[model samples]
Target: MKKSLLTLGAILSLAVISCKKSESGNKSVIKTDSTATIVTDTDGKIDSVSQSSSTVDVNGKKYEKTDFVYKATDGTLVKVVFKNDPKESTVAITSNKKTFTLPKAETKGDETIYKKDDMTARVKGDSLHLEQGDNIIELKRTKI
Candidate 1:
């Protein structure tokens, strides 16, 4: 029985080693597509942004005027009109259908100042600081 089993195992090993997978003459490797396509939908909407500026003649020199918008405390809208010639600018506060304009900044520095008798306002970057007799408030900057 042992001799028969050894002979059967040897024959099976020889059969596996001698068998070469039948190769057809037309056998070739075909590559699969590994790329994908992407689609984007905008719902037929597009936005356009334009540069806004106005030209002003100052002492025979042209100066461009631009307005930067910001939001103040108490939900008030503050629009600051800036000129390219000088560092002078004005802050306009509109609330409840009433608009008040602050005087042009007198001091020159990083912060723009609007000063009057007792009220002083400063605008630096997106910060709005206001001071009166005994009241002081700061506003946050907003983009439009």
Candidate 2:
């Protein structure tokens, strides 16, 4: 009887620990159809030419996040990067009908900030190109 009770206690403890680990291991949610909007922050105004829409789709079965692409009014292709884990993150921009990938790190939170250098693509004289896969988006920049 004592052995059985001890075994039961051990099992319960293991279950509790497993649950806690699962909760902590994956703190991020599966983001789908995430919209990229441009807005002015409290500090000052931005010079973005026009607002464009960007979408993110987490491919089913593969369970991987893909790149999101946005075309600004000035022909600058924008990409979003993961905020939490930027080191292994990527930014893909489709410019001139060609895809350009950018090297970046992943970050977290809704209000995240990103830069152009983080991409695998190039930002030359008057063009910004990004590259990414079907669903992987490059850099997601927030002004908050």
Candidate 3:
């Protein structure tokens, strides 16, 4: 009877140990939409651009972010980074040897508009439109 009780106790102990919870209990998930384009202004308020699969670590916790890039009429590449936080969003445009940092833009209906000096950038859907004085440039998304 004693041997049988000891065996039962050991089995119960093993079962409890096997069912222990995992450590940390923290999980992270990242999702990206390649079809979405982000646009912002060029006013020196924003500095850096974030990558599409960029990971930010805060106190050992990971967060996900995204960015967008456009081609200017001068053939220079323009990169726009996005930040997800309570503070204002920033935008930085890099073309050749010139870089313009801008603030988060205001939304009007389905369009986002950013303006600085005499230039205005409008992002609508997957297209970006830039208007300066009498000239207007339109940029569309291209898959690579």
For candidate 3, the per-residue lDDT at 83 reads 54
Clashes of each: 0, 38, 2
lDDT of each: 0.64, 0.43, 0.64
Give lDDT tens digits, candidate 3, residues 38-127: 434356453343335465788766554556777666665666554544455555555566766555569899887777778777877656
Query: Would you estimate the TM-scores of all the predictions?
Result: 0.47, 0.25, 0.48
Candidate 1: tens digits of C-alpha lDDT, residues 1-144: 999999999999999999887655345867567653222224443312121446778688777665555566777766555455555456565545665567765666767788777878887755778788899877765644
Candidate that scores best on TM-score: 3
Tell me the TM-score of model 3: 0.48
lDDT for each residue of candidate 2 in 1-144, tens digit (9 for 90 to 100)? 999999999999999888743444555766568666554534567535343433444443222233334455554555532222322444444446665444443334432222354333433322333333343333333222
Could you tell me the TM-score of candidate 1? 0.47
Please tell me which model should have the higher TM-score, number 1 or number 2. 1
Cα miss at 38, model 1 (Å)? 32
